[model samples]
Target chain A: MSEEPSPGPVVDAAFFRRWLVAAAAVIDREADQLTELDSPIGDADHGANMRRGFTAARGAIEKEPPETPGDVLAQTGRHLISTVGGASGPLYGTLLRKAGKALGDSAQVTPEQLRDALKAGVDGVAQLGGAAPGDKTMLDALVPAVEALSFALDKGAGLIDALAAARIAAQEGALATVPLQARKGRASYLGERSIGHQDPGATSSALLLGVLADTAEQSAAGGTG
Target chain B: MKMLINVPETVVADALRGMAVAHPELTVDVEHRVIVRRDAPVPGKVGLVSGGGSGHEPLHGGFVGQGMLDAACPGEVFTSPVPDQMVRAAAAVDSGAGVLFIVKNYTGDVLNFDMAAELAEDEGIQVAKVLVNDDVAVTDSLYTAGRRGTGGTLFVEKIAGAAAEEGAPLEQVQSIARQVNQSSRSFGVALSAVSTPAKGSPTFDLPAGELELGIGIHGEPGRERRPMMTAGEIAEVTVDAVLEDLRPQRPVLALVNGMGATPLLELYGFAAEAHRVLAQRNVAVARTLVGNYVTSLDMAGASVTLCQVDEELLRLWDAPVATAGLRWGA
Candidate 1:
C-alpha cells in the first residue's frame, strides 16, 4: 500500500471518466439482451437497470469533471445508488465508493493501488450483498477479475496487460455461471429451474471489466480508441 | 399487451398523480416518487415506511395514510425501490420517535434497505427494519436466498402500523412487526399472467387449462404447473398449503387476495372455500378479508394468507385504519 508515486501508465481522472462512459455505452447496447436474459428467471429489468445506472453515473462524471480518479468514482457511486433500482444499485454503488475511498485522493493510480482499490470494492460488494463467488451473482465475475489482476500485478505484469488478464478471467467466470443453480437474487425464486441460465449480473460484471481493459489499452497506446 | 397506460416510462408517476388527486389525506412527492401522509412526522409517533415495485397496487402506496404506512416509495413495475428514496423518506418523517421500514424478503429490498438504514443513521436519524419472509412453498434454503415474502407483507404492515400509530417506540414497533411476520404463511395460484406497462408482454404464457401453483408475487416461477382446477379445489389447495405452515389451531385472520384482474364474485367464492377448508382443519377464522391488497398487475390469480393470532394481535388488527387500500374501523 505504498504511495511513493510508482511509475505507470497514467490512469488518471480522465481514464476513470472514460471507463464510466465506456460502461454506459456497452450497457446501453446490451440493455435489451440483458432484459431478455433476465426474462426467464427474474423480473426482466437487469439490462434496463444497469443501463439507467451507468447512464446516470456517466452523466454525473461528465458534468462535474472531478479532478482525481477517486473523486470520479465516488461521484459515480452516488449517482448509481440513486438511479438504479433493485439490488444492483446498492451493491455496485458500494463497489465504486469503497474502491474510491481505498485509493485516497491520488490524482493518478498505480497498478498496485488499483489492485488494492478494486479488492476493497469487491469486498465491499460482498459484504453489502451477503454474496460470495459461486453464488451465481456479479461476484462470480468481479471477485475473480480482481484476483487475476492482483496475481498478475504481483508477478510484475504491466498495468494494461494485467487488466487484459482480468477481463478474460471475468468473461470465463461469467460463462461458468451458466451451469450453476442460482442461490441469490430473483432467480433464486426459481430454484433448480434457474440452472442453464447465465446470470445477468455476472454478464454485466464482465462488461465492466472488459471496458476497463479497453480503457487501459486505448489510453496507454496514446490513442483514445 | 392489454394495458390502460400511456408511455411505459410514465406509468408509475402517472398512477402516483392520480392517487394524489383522489386521496386528500396523502401527498405524493413526484420528484422522489414517494407517497407520504398529508400530516407526516406525526408528533410523538413512530413513522412507518414500506414499498416495492409498481405492479403490486393497493400495497405500499395505497396503504399509505392515517393508520398504516407514513410513507411508501414505489419503484418501476416489479422492481425494488432505490435507497435514496427510503433514506429521504425516513429523514422527512422522523419525529424523534424513530422510523420503521417494513421490508419484504427479496435480495433487492434487503440490500437497498440496509444501505438506506446505514445512510439514515449517518445523518443521526434512527431507523429499524422488519423483514417479512413467510412464503412456505419452497423448503430449501440452499436454493432460495430466503423464503420469498408475499401476502404476509400486508399483515406485518397493518399490524405494525397500528402499533406505530399508538406511539410505540421503535424497538416495540419492530418487535411487533417481526412477531406478525413469524405467525403468517401464504400460498399463491396463478390462472394467467400479466403484462406490466414497461414489459408490454405477458410475464409467462399459461396454457388454456393450466395454472401455476405456489407462485411469487412477481410472477416468478411457481412450485409447479398443473391443469387448472375448479374454484373450490384451487381454494382448498392454496389454503391448505398455508395452514400446514401456519398450524393455526386457534383463531386466525384469513385473507383471500386476488392477483389484480380476478372478479369480486370469484374472490368471494375462493374465500368461502378457504374458510371451509380451514374450518375443516380445526382452524377458526375470526376475521376474513377478501380483496386485491397485493396484486400482480392484472394477472388472474389468487393467494391465501393465514396469520395465527392471540389477543394482542387481534386487537392490533382490529385497530382503526384509514389507508386508501384498507379503510374500516376508523
Candidate 2:
C-alpha cells in the first residue's frame, strides 16, 4: 500500500479528550435509539445509562485535564464505573481502565500502541462480562473493531484510514448481533425472543468507534495545516 | 410517568429519606445508597448483604433488619447498584464472621456483586456470594444468561438471614442460601406492562385482553403472551410451573407474591386458588406468604415461588425475625 504523505495527527492527551467529548455528544444524540433497542429484549435504560456515563466521563476529563492519554482513559474509566449504573458501567469501565493501564502513562500513543491497548481493553470486557464475540454483547462490535484496527495498522494503513476501517467493522459487528441470541446481560433473559433485535451495547460500541474515527479524521485534517 | 414523586431524579433518594423516618431501626445512607441495620455487625454473626434495583421495594432494602439482611444496597430503579455501594455495605456490616452476598441473578446484579465480592475480599474481608436464579419462566439456562432471579429471592434472604442471625458461619450461611435458591422455583404472569420513572412510559406493551406468562420482574417479555386468564387459571398455571421444576416430595414454603401494583385483596384471592392447585398436585404447603414482597413497580401481576423445605429450612423459616418489610414472632 502506498503511504500517505502525512502520518496524521499525533495521538495525544488532547486527541483522547476530543474523542471523549465527541463520544458524549454522539451518545446523547443516540440515547433514545439505544434505549429503543433495549426495550424489546433488555431493560430500556442503556441509552440513559450511557448518556449519564459518557457525560460524566467528559465532564471529569475536562475538569481534571489529565496530562497523559493513559491518565485520561483511566480517569474516564473510573468516572464511568461510578456514574453509570448497571452491567454497562463495570463492563465499559473495565474496558477503558484496562486499556488505559496497558497504555502505561504514555505521553502520546501511536496507532499501533492504541490498537494493542484497545485489544487489552476488549479482552478485559470479555472477562468481566463472561461473554464471547457471538454473545450479542458490546464485544461483538469491540472485538472485531479492535481486530480491524490491528489488521489495518499492520497492513500499513494510516491512522485515519485504519480508524475508519475499524468503525465500519464495528458497525458490521453491531448489525450481526441482530440475528444471534443473546448469551449474556438482560437480553439473554428473553432467550429465543432476543433474536432479531440488535444489541444496544453493540450499537453503542459502534457509535463510540465511529466517533473516535470522526474525531481522528478531523484532527488529522487540522494537523495538516 | 405520572407517578408520585417530585421528580424522577430524586425518586430513589426521596424513598430512602422516607424509609429512614419510617424505620428508624435501619441506618439509611442516601448519598452512598447503602442501608444497614442500626445495630449492625452484631458481634460474631455473619453479615448478610443483598441489593438490586430500587423499584423492587422491601426487597434488599426493606428486608434489612435483625433476621434478614445486615445491609442492603439500593440502586437506581431497575438498575443494579455499583460495587462501591456493596463494598461499603460489607465494611459497615462485617463483624469478623465475614459477609455473604445474596445476589439476584440479573446480568447487572451478578456483575456488580461479583466485582464487589472481589473488592471486599481485597480489603481482607471474607466474602461469599449465593445467586438466586429461581425464575423458571425462561427454560434454557445453558443458552441464556440463566434463569432470572425473581420472587424466590425473598425466600433465600429470609431463610439464610435467619441462619446468619443464629450465628451461623459465612460458609454455612452461604450454603443454606444456595440450598434455598436450589429448592425454589418461580413463575410470574403480567396482566399489564410496567412503567419506569425515568421513561415516564410503559417499558413494554402488553395489549389489553392479553397477558404475558413468565414475565420478568424488570418487565422483560416472558415465554409467551396469551389471552388474559382468570385468577384461578393464572394461579394453577403459575404454581404448576414451579412444581414441575421443583417436584418437591417434602412440604414447600409458598409465596404468592404481588408484582408491585397488585393489591392484597386480589393476592389473597389468588393465593386461595394457588392453595387449591398445590393441594390438587398433592404438594403439602408448610408456610404460605401472600403479599407484595418482591415487586416490579406497578406491573399488575403476581408470581408464585415455592421452596421445597426440609425440617432445618422449616425451623429457620420459623425463626424470630424483625424487619421493615416482614416481622413475625419477634
Candidate 3:
C-alpha cells in the first residue's frame, strides 16, 4: 500500500458537499424508479425514505456548512439516521457515519484515505445489517465498488479513473442482485419470489457511487469551481 | 382511498395528537414521537420498551402504561422507528434497574433496536433484547428474515410487562419475554387487503371472494391465498396452523385478535369457533382476549395467538394490568 505521490486533486469539504448535493438530485430524480423496484418485494418506501433523508441532509449542510470532510459526512449520516425511518436508515447511516469517523477530522483527504474510509463504512453496514454481498442488499453494490476503487487506487490510477471503475463495479453489482434471492430485509419475506426484482437498496447505492465519480470528474476538470 | 385523514403525510402525527388528548396519563412527545408512561423510570422496576410501525395502533403506543411498556416509539406507517427514538426512550425510562427491549422480528425493527441497544449500552445503561417471532405461517428461518411477529407480540408485552412491574430484574424480565415468545404461535387470515395512507390504495390487491392465509401484520404476502370461507372454516384453519407449531401440553392463553377493520361482532363469533375447535382438540384455555389488540391498518382480518401457560405464567397472566389497549382487574 504505497502512497506513490498521486497526481489527482485531494478532496476537501467542498468536494464532499458537491457530491452529496448531486447525490440528492439524482435520488430525487430516480425516486419513482426506486419505489417501483421496491413494490414487488419490499414495502415500496425506499425511494421516499431516501428522498426524505437526503433532501433533509442537503438542507442541513446548506443551512450550516461544515468545516472538514469528516464533519460533512458525519453530519449527513446523523441527519439521514434521524430522518429515514426504516432498515435502510441505520444501514445507510452507518455506512457514512463510520466512514466519516474513519476520515478522522482531516480537512483534506487523499484518494487512499477516502477508499479506506469507505471500506470502513461498508464494513459497518455489513455488521449492522448482518448482510453479505449476495444477500440482495446495498452491500452487493457497495462492497464491489469499494474494492474496485481500492484496487484502482492501489494500481496508481487517477482519482477520476478509480472512481469511474468503482461506479461501474457498483452498477454491475446492482444488476447482479436481480437473480439472487434476498436473505435479509423486507424483501427476504418474499423468499423465492424476491429473485426477479432488482434490489432498490443496491440500485440506490450505485446511483450514489455514480454521483461521486461524476463529482470527481467534474472537480478534476475544474468544472465544480 | 377515502380515509378519514386530513392528509396522508400527517396521519401518524395527527393520531399522536389525538392520543395525547385522550390519554392524560401518558406523556406523549409528539415532535419526537416517543410515548412514555407519565411516571416513567419507575424507581427500580425494569424498563420495558417496544415499538414498530405506526399502523399497528394499540400494539406499542397504546400499550405504553402501568403494566406494559415504559416507553413506545412509533414510526411511520409500516416503517421501523429510528434508533434515536429508542435511545431517547431508553434514556427517559431507565431507572438504574436496566432496560429490556421487546422487539418484533421484522428486519427493520431488529436492526433499529440493535443499534439502539448498542448506543444505550455505550451510555452505561445495561440493555437486553427479546425478539418476538411467533408467526407459525413462516416455515423457514434460515433462508428468510425469520417469522413475522404478529399477534403474539401482545402476549409477550403483557406477560413480560407484568413480570417487570413486580420488580423483576432486567434478566428476569428479558427471560420471561423470551419464554413468552417461545411458547406462543400465531396465524392470520386476511379477508381483504390493507390500505396504507401513504400508498392511498391497497398495499396488495385482494379481490372480492378471496382471502390471504397467514398474512403478516404489514400486509406482506402470506403462505397462500384462497377463496373466502366462513368464520368457522377460517377459525379451524387458523387454529390448526397455530396448534401445529405449538403442541401445547398446558392450558393456554388465547388471543383472538382483529386486524384494524374487523368489528367485534365478527371477532366474537370467530372466537367462539376458535374456542370450540380448541376444546375438541383437548387444549384447555386459561384465559382469552378477543379484540383489536394487534391490527394491520384497515385490513379485514383476524389473527390467533396461543401461549401455553405453566403455573408461573398463568399467575403472571392473571396479574392486574392497566394500559390504554389492555386493562383488567386493577
- Give the candidate number with the greatest DockQ: 2
Which segments of model 1 are wrong by more than 4 Å?
A1-8, A223-225
> For residues B163-244, what per-residue lDDT tens digits would candidate 1 score against the true structure?
9888889999999999999999999989887776656787566788999998888878788899989988997889888877
DockQ of each two-chain model: 0.66, 0.74, 0.60
Best by lDDT: 2
| lDDT digits (tens) for residues A1-225 of candidate 1 | 233323446888999998999999999999888887787788777887888899888887888899999988888988888888788888888899999998899988888899999999999999878888988999999999998998888877788878989999999999999998888888887888889989989999999999999998888677542
- Native contacts matched by each model: 0.72, 0.70, 0.60
TM-score of each: 0.96, 0.97, 0.94
RMSD of each: 2.9, 1.6, 2.7
Candidate 1 CAPRI grade = medium
Clashing pairs in 1: none
**Model 3 chain A: worst 10 consecutive residues (lDDT sum):** A1-10
- Model 3 accuracy (lDDT, Cα): 0.90
lDDT by residue for model 2 (A1-225), tens: 245636677888898899999999999999989988988888788898899899989988999899999988888998988878799999999999999999997888988889999999999999888899999999999999998998988888888888999999999999999999998888887878889999999999999999989988899888731
The lDDT of each candidate is 0.87, 0.91, 0.90
DockQ of prediction 1? 0.66
Which runs in model 2 stand beyond 4 Å of their true positions? Answer: A1-5
Candidate 1 to native Cα RMSD, angstroms = 2.9
